[model samples]
Target: MSDPRTPRPTRNEAPQWQSEDGSLILAKCEDCGEPHYYPRVICPFCSSDNLSWITCSGRGRIYSVSVFRRAEPPYALAYVTLDEGIKMMTNIVDCDLDAIRIDDPVAVVFKDRNGIPTPMFAPVQG
Candidate 1:
C-alpha cells in the first residue's frame, strides 16, 4: 500500500536512483574510485564527470538513527553507511522502532510512494 502523503517522484529528476522494480541504482566515479548516493552526474569528491551507474549491494549499517514515535504511525530515519562506502538518508521499517540502534546491520527494501519505488532499510533478518 502506498501512503497518500508521500510525494511522487518527478520524471525530470536527475540520476534516478531506484528502479521501478525496486533495485538500487548507484553512481560510481571511475576517476576517484568512490561511490556516492543521491546519484549525481559529477563526482562530489573529485569533481569529475566520469560516473557510471551500478547495482548496489543494498546492505549497510546504521550510522545514526532517530525514531519518531510521536508520529501517527511512527517511523525511524537514519543515515546508513552502505557496503559500497556511501551513506544515504533513508527510513528504517518493518521492525520494532524501539530496537533500532546505531551500527545495526540493515538491508534495503522498497516501498511504493505514489508509483515510485522508494528505497528504505530494515534490520537484516537472521
Candidate 2:
C-alpha cells in the first residue's frame, strides 16, 4: 500500500503522455495575420503552410456552459473563448456552479487524466 497522504497520480501526470512542453494550438494564414486553432497541415483560409505554434496567455471568458446533473452528478461543460480569439470546449473547476456565468473570466489549468494533460478552466481571481 502507498502512503495515504500522497496525492493519487492522474493520467496526465503519469510520466508517459505529459506534454513535451506547453504549446498553444496556433496556425497563421498568409492572407491574414490572425491565428487559428484545430491545427492543420495548411492554413484553411490562405492554404499556406507557414503556420507556427505559439504560447497562449491561457486566459478566456465563459462563452457558454451546461450543468450535467445526470451524467456526472455536478459536472459542467463549458465553451471558453480564449483571449487570442479562439474558442475551446473544456470543463470548469475550482468553483461552484452558482458562481459560474456567461462572460465570467477564467484561467487555464492542466489536469492529468490517465497520463493525458486535459485542459480545464478555473475562475479567474481578481
Candidate 1 lDDT over 1-126, as tens digits, reads 866767565432334535765567787889988877776668989999988877888898999998888999899989999988888999999999999989999998888777666789999954
Q: How many residue pairs clash in each candidate?
A: 0, 6
In candidate 1, position 5 carries an lDDT of 65
Cα lDDT for residue 75, candidate 1: 92
Q: Per-residue lDDT tens digits of candidate 2, residues 1-126? A: 553423343432233123356433445565556566655667767787776655678789999999887764488889999999888878898899877899999988777655456667899965
- Considering summed lDDT, which 10 consecutive residues are worst modelled in model 1? 9-18
Candidate 2 worst ten-residue window by lDDT:
9-18
Candidate 2's error at 39, in angstroms?
2.0
Give the residue spans of candidate 1 off by over 4 A: 1-16, 20-22
Candidate 2, lDDT over the whole model: 0.70
Q: How close is candidate 2 to the true structure, as a TM-score?
A: 0.73
Residue pairs in collision within model 1: none
